[model samples]
Structures are given as C-alpha cells and as structure tokens.
Target: MKKKLGMFAGLVLFVVLMAACAADSSQEESDSGDSNSSGSEDSSAENQDTTEISFIHWRGEDEEVFDDIIGQFEEENPGISVQMNTYPSEQYQSNAQQMLRDGSTGDVFTSFPGTQFETINNAGFFTDLSDEEFVNNFAETSLEVGQSEGSQLAVPYQMVFNMPVYNKGMFEELGIEVPTSWSEYQAMAETLKENDITPIAFPGADIGPNQMMNSMMMNNAKNEDIFAQLESGEETLTNDWWINTLEDFQHFNENGYLQEDALGTNQDSAMQMVADEEAAMLATGSYHMASLKELNSDLELGFLPPITVSEEEVEYEGIHTATFMLAVNKNSEKKEEAKAFIEFLSQPDIASQYANETGQHLTVNDVDYESESLQNTSHWIDEKDTRFQPRYLIKEAAVEDAVLGSIENVLGGTSPEEAADEAQQVVEENID
Candidate 1:
C-alpha cells in the first residue's frame, strides 16, 4: 500500500515539472517574436516620418548646380527629400499653369514676373509667403516682382541683365569700342561684317527676338512704361516706339548683320556661333553667359545693349529682370517641407554656392560671386543705369505675343509698318 501511494506522488510531480518547462519554452519563443515585430514597426515608422517634396522649374540648364544644392539640403535635413523637375523654358511657359492646377507635380514651382505671376496668383495657386522668415532675405525690388497686391506670393531667385552678350576678345581684336549711339552701333556692325564676322547671332525661333527687344527699345521709347501704357489703352502697338523697334530688326536683317536663316536659328545655335567666334554677339541675356562659356571656356564676354538712341537720349544703359519667381503650391501636402527647402536656398552661403556654381546673379543680398563671368558683369547690377525689362511689364499674354510676334514677322520679310498694324489689331482684339 505504501509503495503504490509513493508511485502516485512521483507521477504527479513529473507532470507538474513538465508543465513548468513547457511554459518557459513558450514564453521564450513569444519574446523572440515580439522583439522582431517591434523592430519592424520601428523601421516602418522611420520610413513614414520622411517627407518628399517636388521642386519644379524651367531652368534645365541649372540642373547640375541645383542637384548639388539639393544634395546638401538633404544632408542638412535628414527627414526630407527633394525631387527636381525641369522643362524647357518655352514648354514650361506654355504648360506650367495646367501642371500646377493639379498640385501633384509641383510642391514648389516658379513663374515669370508679370502675366504668369498674375494668372497664377489670381488662380490662388501660390501660398502667401509674406510671413515667411526667408522672405526677409531678398531685396524689396526682388520681392516686389513676386508680390500680388499686398500679399507676398513668390520670391524671385535670379537678377539678370537681359541685354546682348558680346565677345570682348573679338571686339578688342577688331579695334571696336562699345557703342553709345545708334549710328555708332551701325558702324560697329558694318565693321564686323567687313571682317567676315556675323555681327549678331539672333535666335528668332523662340524667346530670342522678344528678349532683344528689351535693349532695342529701352531708350527709343518716350516713356519707360510704354508696355504698361499699351496695356492701359493709352498707347497702341502701332505707336512710333513699337514701329521703330521692328524697323531695327528689319535693318539688321537687310544689313546681313544677323546670322543666316536667323528666324530658323534656335538659342543653342546662336550661342554656339558667338562661342566659336563666328559671331561677334548673341542677342540674348547675361543668363546665358555660363552656357556660352561652357561651349568655350577661353571666351571673354561682356554685355552690350543696342544703344538705339543718341548718347544724350539714353535713359537706361541695360535691362534687368527679376525672374524665375519661386512659390509654394497652395495645395501641397508637404507645404512645410517645401518652404523649408526654399529657406535653405535663401541662406547666404547656400545662395552663394548656387550663384557661383551656376554663374547666376542671385536676388539674395551679399552673395559673393566667384565665377569670372559673374564678376566681370557684376558691376552692371549697381554701377550702370539699368531699367526693368519692359517686355515683362506687359500683363496680357496675347498682347505680349502679338508684340513679340511683330519682330518675328519683320524678320520673316514683312514690312515694319505692316507688322505693327497686324500686332495692333491682335492687341485690340484681345484688350477690347
């Protein structure tokens, strides 16, 4: 009887011990699973914390410089990433509105000074950046270009002289001086032609003629705000000032001062002609200086506005435009991130880096320019009598197009008078 009772006790103890061991093993397995699950959750949370923003602009040429800046921005901001989107200037000018309307492509975007800015602002596509701290970093003149009414809508990033870029070495070699009067300019062109050099590589295909018109009519117009006058119906495209500008184009064409097939020549080809020393000047802006230098690093360059008026009548020496206005999309999901990226760019050191790398004249104050091209032309920013580009002051695209198209029409064999009349009709149709 004792032996049977002892055997039952032993069996019960064995069963209890087995249950305890099983529970310990189960708890060990559960802890291991929990540890892996917690690690995965942490990794997923880290991924969710990162924000990506899109920066859209028309400066395909500045892609490399911008990429470098973006890389620095990402390093400084570990939680954010930037995706850059660039388009050709013409395509961006035409399609930027449609792309921005959806709010998917451009978390941050750029617009031109007058009509495009007004159109985009009126549509409420821009965030009011009036209160942003970064807004204080830019000059008031630069800021004004981006403002609509009282609200600070955008920030102009580049201050560029929209005048012709000439080959300094070529001019020196030919014993020619910068002209201060229309007659002198004509003589200079004749000399260049005499030397078997194209005087002006005019790219009439896209924005070339429109850009050149800024310098061509700077002093010829009686009023500085002639384009504004046209918009207000106080003047017409058929005004003498407008006709004279077209006639200048005709004179250049007739004199063989422009490149062969000028109307068909694009900006790139025009730039190359000057770079290769085949042409003495490119009827474009200082914004293209870096590009021209890229084609020929040894090329010495300078700005030369067409001096259309007598030296005594010259009111402005060159044209300056505050363009590529940067704005945050009003509907962006990552507004904070987008604004942060802009703020990063607005910093003086960063802006300097960008300016030097891209050879752009930045709107940011006190940025040190290291590029030879920028240093050579930096004096024009303050020392010269530069006027805001009248071409940008036109607020209606149709009217602006008609005005610019008149120059193209004259280049394509139409008389200046006929082109002026045609442009006036289009302007009246659009405005009236």
Candidate 2:
C-alpha cells in the first residue's frame, strides 16, 4: 500500500484518538472565519478594533490541534483573532484561488506556490516581505521557494521529500543492506522477488501518486536543465537523459516487481502494501513517517535516492522543501497582526509543538529533530546545498509541474522522449 502525509494518516487507523481528545479548549475555539461582511452598506461605518486573520487549509483530524495552537496565540495577544478557514482537500486549491481573487477571503493562507506563485505574487496579492526579520530564521531553501523577483512572498511552514522507505526488519531477515547504486538496487529487487515478495509498490492511478515516479526520473536523470532549454525554444525533450530514465522505469514495470494492479492502485492501498509486508520498499516523503508509526510504530523506514545513470555523477539528494508555507496578504488591513502571528509560529516552542502534534517536519533551525531519518535527511540537504547543481534542483515550480505532467505521460505508455517533447511544447506555449 502507498502512504499518506501528516497526522491524520496515522490517527485514522486507531479510530479512537478522536473521541478522547474532543474536549480540549484550545482546539475547539479556533474559528473558521469565512463569514463575509454584511451587505447593503452599513448605515454607518463602524470602528473595528480587533484584527481578524483568515487562512484556508485542508481538512483533517489535526485541525483541532491547529485551532488549539491558534487559540493560545490569541490569548497571549489580545485584540487579534485567527479565522482558520478550511475546505475539503479536493476543493482546496480551487477555493483558495477564488478566495484569493475575491479580495475578502483569507488575509493569510497556505499554498504550494511552485508554478502559480509567480502569477499570484505578480498580481500584487501577497506582500513583499524580503526585509522582514523572520525571513532570516527560515532555512535558505524554504525561503527560496517563496521568493519572487528578489522579494519574499511567503513563509514555508513544512518540509517534505520524496525517497525510498524500506522495511528494515524484512531486509535484515534477507541479510541485505540498503542498496546504494543502480546495480545494487536491481539485484536487491531480484532477490526480493526470488523470495516471493513484491520488491516495491507503486500507485500510478492518480496524478499525485504518479508524480513520485516522475520526480524520481527528473532527479536521477538530471533533467534540471531541460526546463530552461525547452522554455528558450532551443531544445526538445528527445534528449538522451530523459529517454534513458523512461526506459529504466519501463524495465522496472515489466519485471513483475511492482505491486499487482499497480496502474489501478491508489495511495492508501499502496501504502498498505508496505505496512502489510507484501512489499519491502515504497517511495514517499518524510511526512509518511508519522502515518507509518500509527500502523506499526515499530516498522523501520529508510530513504534511498532515486537511481541514476548520468555520466556526471550527480549528487543523490532526494527532492524536498519546507511544506506548504504561510503568506500574509499585502493588501490586508491587518498586516501588523498577521506579521506578529508569523513570528509567533516560528518561535522554537511553537514549531516544536507543531512537529510533535502533527508529525510533520518543519524547516526551522530552532527545533532539534527527534527522528533519526529526519536528522540524516537534514545532513544530506546540507551537503546538497553546498554543491548547488541546477540539474535536479527544480528552481521553479512551473518547471516542476510541467515535469510532473510529462512524467505522467511516460508512465501512461508515452515514451520518455515523447513526454519530454510534449512538456517542452507546453513550456514554450505557456511559460513566458
């Protein structure tokens, strides 16, 4: 089975964590402030002393915890209130677009801000917070994700990465160490199959799950240059590196190693494969760790960089970023209070609490990570940061999305070259 991210992923299995924590005060008072102003123009404009902050996020079991945290913030700072607006996960992006454009929705909100970030930032919806003091506190990569044209447009709150997770116990029983090279990876898969186990699990049914496959290809193939090359109209996706990675993925699919019904499996079912020990390996991010613990806190998880065949000996850091970040509306009347909340959230105490409560890794330097995998990942990120290669870095979100779409095509029977070509065309036609 495939894994999911965040707190609900774990707590969902037990079914009773919800009932026991229902009466928590801080959790319940956090309001969903979507109520719009009254119509017909008030007979007299009233003076409002309280500053209200609104945000839109995905619905989950952890919302109560979030509200509880916000409630504490409101208590410490009177005359301000947080209006946490939430939407079903399916409608979150679209609704956020409407609200952002509506001018009266959230004064603050969560966004991936990869491709669409430039569009939103350029339209003058988010404030330029480059000079803000909190900017210095964020990891450089987190801040970079939210930067637009030399100015900071958002604050990254969570960190995520896509890599391999292995069942250490299963590997130990097989007397195998985690493979570090492409050759070793193939051998491990073969050995697992010989032992009558699925070597790995993949979910190609939805775009989100399918995206992991694509991201791995991009990372391993070092097609980081492909985005700009195609955008400039000087090249096409028929490049060798792209072709090589697609063929590699094709070989893996044909080998009878991936989960059965792979093309039809969803993330939930795919995650279960790993937990059930039907498969020994799964590809996912650190966020899945919290969920994995819920199923079996004893299940051992490890990460491996996507395999590569590049001649340049590319660095093998996995793809990751501070999770979706919080940005203040530059046009909002409550900028001061919103900024204060931003500072409050970044405090070591608050970040640590969020990490513990949600099981999501944050990018702040203030907190000490308790998880071994997280500590190792942080070290790997530091190494990659120093090398600074453009190839797998995915500097722009637009490029990342385009790459993901192309990967989907390759996974769905289109050749990697063809997928790259289509992606290049899209870049030329859409990106400026």
Candidate 3:
C-alpha cells in the first residue's frame, strides 16, 4: 500500500512540471511576436520622418506669422519640415521670373496672376495642382486666377482692392460726405484743396500711382471691354470711354489735386503725403491700413472708392485680387509634402491668423479676421459692387506700356487726348 501511494505522488509531480514547461514556451512566442510588431512600426515611423518641403514667398508684414503657422503645421505632421524663403517686395517679380527661367528655384514659390504667370505656366515651370483638393476649397473668383486652361499653376491666397482710404476725422472736420460718383470725387477734391489740404496725394515717381489712376479711370468707363480688344490689337482705343477716362486722369493732374513731385515720387513717399496730413485722401489697398494705423492709431481711416456713374451703383467685373500666389516647382523632389504645406495654409484658422497679423485680407471663404479696417473695406466693396481692377483686366506688360507708362506723359503736361493717342499706338504695336 505505501509503494502504490508514493508512485501516485510521483505521477502527479511529473504532470505539474509538464504543464509549467508548456506555459513558458507559449509566453516566449507571444513576446517574440510583440517585438516583431513594434520593430515594424518603428521602421514605418522613421520612413515618414524623411519627408521635407521648401517654401518661398515675397516679404511683407506677414513673414513672422507665416513662419509661426508653418512651425505649427510641421508639428501636426511629424514627418514634414518646412523651409521658408522670402524676397524683398520691390524685387519679387524679377527675382521670381529669373528663378522660373532657371528651373532651380525652391520647391514652392510665388507668382502673380497675369500674362507673366500665364507665360510661366505655359512654359511648364510650375507644378499643375488642378486636381488637388485644396484647389476646390477657394472661392470661384479666387480660384480663377490660378487656373490656366485646365491646369492650376498656383494657389490663390488672398484678394486685395485698390480702394480709396480717407481720414475720417479730416472728412468730418471738413463736413464732407464720402463721394459716390466721379463728379462728387472731383468736387470733394476741390473742397479739400479749398481747405488748404491737397485733395488727392498721389506720387507718380513710381509706376504705382499711374497704375492706380489708370485702373480707376477704366473702372468708371462706359466701354470696359475695350481693354481686352485693345490688348489683342483687334480694337483701337477709339472708344469714347477710353478718351473720357484719360481726360479724367488729366483733370486730376491739371487741377493740382495730386502732389507736385508725383512724377518723381514712388508710392511710399506719396503715402507720406497722407501720413503728414498734406493730403485729405489717398487711393490705396486695404493692406495700407496697418501702416496707416502704425503712423497714427487714432487717425480715423475709412474707404471711399466707388464704381458708379451716379450716386446709384453700376455693374462691376474685375479681378481685384492680391495677384500673389503660391506655386510648386515642377522639378521638386518633395512635391507632395510641399502641396500639403499649401493645404495647411488654406485652413481658415491659419488664413485668419495670417491676415490679422499682417493686416491683409485673405481669400479664405467665410473666414473673418480681427481687423475692423478689413471688415469695413470689404463691406464697402460689397456695397459698391466693386470688382477687380480694370488694369488687371489685361496682361501686365501691355497695361504697363499702353496705360501705365503713357500716364506719365499726361502728368507731365501733355493733353489727355494726345496721351490717349500715344497709348493707343502702344496697344497697336502689341496687337497681332
């Protein structure tokens, strides 16, 4: 009986040992599987960390805001890094043009929406982003500028108008209501002059003022379609509207409503006229509000550019956009990631932050910035039904020679009719 009991105990111990060995083998396999899975995940994460993008744009007040937003974007996207580059505003166009010609520019770049941009697009220098989801997120008009034929060469980031900004205190003190028509504008200028203030403080030293004058005239013209025909050489500047517009420009210059050295002064010096209170009003973009505020935060600044024939409003059709765009180099190695960066910029929060920081209105749909000036200007634009500037209606070069350059002659004392004729000759030369 004792031998039998001992044998039974030995059998039970052997069974317990066998169960322990099986449990250890299964635990080892489970640990090995977990190790393999973790290793695979680490390799995948490392692969994603290699993606990098290079971005470039022109310098403005928004540079710091842009960099901050980019840093945030990089944080959200662990695998991506953004490299930002900027060029001075004065040299932006030429610098971008030269870079496009060389095809050695950064992965991302800036371009305007006009003949030069179209030319660049046709040359296949910029990546086509027509199918991108980001392209669909913009307003129709904003998107139109970036689309060439069927391809999108750039992303539209903002829209700006060449509206008139006035000193509210000055207007109130002079008992002047904002002008709503061309006649009222002229009368207002005269009134301002009578008050010992220059009615319009324009600087013709740089090509900017002439460009603004030309756009304003065309906006108030009877035949707005003549610009396209004139550009193509299919139509001459024989339209009454063209002649009348030129006459109005001459009227402003002849009346001494503009500054004396306007012909020799750039827009910056011209703006100083407003800053110093030598002028009652200055025609400029909404972006100028920041600088104006910086000069005099208490200065009551308001917008007054109207598109109309009388006090009543008229139809408007123009491309009043920033003319600045973000494009991708077609030869970029990191095109996808660069595109993702652009996508991040289009987000409403990002766009609003940028505009608020820079004091520029962005093209983001239904997004509002904290700028009362921008809100007021945008509301005023809608109220007046102002569209894009007519100067942007045609290509830049044609507008430069035919419209912008010839305005200098008019300001220099040539008759508006003669200046118009000379400008017509330029249009004819560029025609096919």
Candidate 4:
C-alpha cells in the first residue's frame, strides 16, 4: 500500500513539472510577438508625423540648387519633406493651373510675372501671403510685382536685367565703348560686322525678341509704362514710339546686324553663337549669363542695353523684371509647411547661397553676391536707371501677340509703318 501511494505522488509531481515548462514556452512566444507589433507601430507613427509637400516651378536649370536647399530644409524640419516638380517653361505656363486645381500637386508653385500672375490670381488659386512675416523681408518694389487688388498673393524671387548679353572681352579688344545713344549703338553694330562677328544673335523663334523689346523700348517710349497706357485708352500702338521700335528691328535686319536666319534661330542657338564667339551679343537677358558661362568657362559677359534715345533723352538705361513669382496653393492641406519652406528661402543666408550658386540675382535684400557675372553687373541694379519690363505690362494676350508680332513682321521685310498699322488694328480689336 505504501509503494502504490509513493508512485501516485511521483506521477503527480512529474505532471505538475511538465505544465510549468509548457507555460514558460508560451509566455516567451507571446513576448516575441508583442515586440514585433510594438516595432511596427512605432514605424507607422514616424511615417504619419512627416508631412510631404510639393514645390512646382518651370526653372529646370535650378533643380540642383533647389535640391540642396530642400535638403537643408528637411534637416531643419524633421517633420516636413519637400518634393520638387519641374516642367519646361512652356509646359508649366500651359498646364500649371490644371495641376493646381487637381489638389494633388503643387502645394507651392511659381508663375511668370504679369500675364501668368494675372490669370492665376483671377482664378483665386493663390493663398493670400500679405501678412506673412517673410513678405516684409523683400523690398516693396520687388513685392509690388506680386501684388493684386490690395492683397500680396505671391513673392518674386528673381530680379533680372531684361537686356542683351554682350561679350565684354570682344568689346575691349575692339576698342569699343558701351553705346550711349541710338546712333552710337548703330556704329557699334557696324564695327562688330566689320570685324566678321555677328552683331546680335536675335532668337526670333521664342521669347527672345519679346524680352529684348523691353530694353529696345526703354528709351524710345514716351514713358516707362507705355504698354499699360496702351492697355488703357491713354495711348495707341500707332504712336511714334511704336513705329520707331519697329523701325529699329527693320534696321537690324536690313543692315545685316542680326544673325543669319535670325527669325528661325532659337534661344539655345543664339546663346551658343555668343558663347562660341561667333556673335558679339545675344538679345537675351542677364538670366542667361550662367548658361553662357557653362558653354564657355572663360567667357567674360556684360549687359548691353539698346540705348534708343539721345543721351539727354535717356530716362531709363535698361529694364529690370521681378519674375518667377512664388505662391502657395490656396486649397493645399500643407499650407503652413509650404509657407515655412518659402520663409526659409527668404532668409538672407539661404537666398545668398542660391544667388551665388545659380548666378541669379535674387530680390532678397542684404544678400552678398559671389557670382562673377552678378558682381560685374551689380551696378545695373544699384546705379543705372532701370524701368520694369514694359513687355510684361500688357494684360491682353492678343495685344502682346500683335506688338511682338510687329517686330517679326518688320524682320520679314514689312515696312515699319505698315506693321505699326496692323498692330494698332489688332490692339483696337482686342481692347474695349
């Protein structure tokens, strides 16, 4: 009886031990599963904390600089990420409004001054930035370009001289001085032709002629706001100023001062001509200086304003345009993040870095420039009397087309008077 009782006790003890071991194993498995679930939850929370915003613009050439800027921004704001979207200038101009309307793109976007700004602002796509603290960092003159109907809708990031870029080394070698009058400019062109160099590589195929017209009319127009006056009932395209500007285009064509097949030449080809020393000047803007230098690392370039008046009558020497206006999408969910990015850009150190790296003249004040071209041309912004680009003042597309088309017509052998008359008729038809 005693042996049987001991055996039962041993069996019970063994069973209890087995149960204990099984419970230990189960607990270990549960802990492992819990660890994995906790890790996954943490990762998901991290992702949810980050806010990604898209910045859309047409300056594809600025991708590298902006990438660097965005990296800095991300590091500073761990919760925010910026994705840059770039389109070609023409494509952006045509499709940006749609992209903004879709609400899936362009938390922040850039637009060209005047027409693009007007169209986009009219659609109420821009967030009102009037009260942003960063807006005060920019000069009032620069801010005016982005204002509409008492609201500051955007901010202009670039300040560029809308004049021709000339080879300073060539001018120095030929013992030529910068022309101060229309007659002197013609003589300078003649000298360039005499030296077997194309005087001006005019890119009539694209926006080149339109940009050049700003400087071409700087001194010829009766006032700086001639296009605005024409837009109102105060002026007409058939005025002497318009006729004289068309005649200037004709003179360039008739005197062989422009490149061969100038009207067919595109902006890139024109830039190449100047960079390769085949032409002495390109009828483009200061914005192309970096590109020209990239083509020829040793090219010394300068701005050449087409002085269309006598020295005494020259009220303005060149044209300055505040363009590439940046604005936030009114409907964006990431409005605060987008504005923070712009405010980061408005900081003087960041703006200077962008200006020096891209060779662009920024509108941000107190920015120290290190670009060679920018340093050389800084006087144009500081000392020279420059008017805002008149080409941008025309709000009507048909009128702008007609006015620019008049230059093309003159280049194609139409008389200046006839071109002026045709442009005037188009203007009358388009306006009230």
Estimate the Cα RMSD of every predicted model relative to the unseen true structure.
13.5, 13.5, 17.4, 13.7
Q: Which portions of model 2 show Cα errors greater than 4 Å?
A: 1-49, 59-61, 88-90, 207-210, 218-220, 310-312, 371-378, 383-432
Please identify which of the two predictions, 1 or 3, would achieve the higher TM-score against the true structure: 1
lDDT of 1 at 274: 93
Cα lDDT, all candidates:
0.87, 0.65, 0.69, 0.87
Which candidate leads the pack in TM-score? Answer: 4
Name the better of 2 and 4 by lDDT.
Answer: 4
Order by TM-score, highest first: 4, 1, 3, 2
For model 3, what is the alpha-carbon lDDT of residue 394? 73
lDDT by residue (tens digit), candidate 3, 1-432: 899999999999999999999988766643322222234667645644345565667855667888899889988997776667788765776666666554334677878766657667767878889888887666665677777777777877877766667788889988998775767877788898888898766756654553365345645563556667777766665466766666666777788777776677777776777878888767666667788777767667776653335645445522256567888888666678788888888888888888888877777666676877776666543454555556656774765567766667777888777888888877777766
> What's the TM-score of each model vs. the native?
0.87, 0.79, 0.81, 0.88
Tens digits of per-residue lDDT for model 4 on 300-319? 88999888778889898788
Query: Using alpha carbons, what is the TM-score of model 4?
Result: 0.88
Summarize candidate 1's per-residue lDDT along 1-432 as a digit string, tens digits: 999999999999999999999988866643322222234667646646566677999998789989999999999998887889999987888889888886766888999888888888888999999999999888776688888778999999999888899999998989999998989999999999999999999988765587898998888785777878787789987878888888888998998989989999999889889988999999989888999999999998899988877888988899999888889999777789899999999999999998998888989888999988899998887799898899888888899889888988999999999999999999888885
**TM-score for candidate 2:** 0.79
Candidate 2 per-residue lDDT, tens place, 34-101, comes to 22233222411331444567766764656887888899898898767787878875577555666777
Off by over 4 Å in 3: 1-49, 101-104, 222-224, 306-308, 317-319, 380-383, 396-399
In model 1, the number of clashes is: 0
Candidate 4 regions off by >4 Å?
1-45
Poorest stretch of ten by lDDT in candidate 4: 29-38
Score residue 132 of candidate 4 by CA lDDT.
Answer: 96
Q: Can you list the residue pairs that collide in candidate 4?
A: none
Clashes of each: 0, 12, 6, 0
lDDT of 1: 0.87
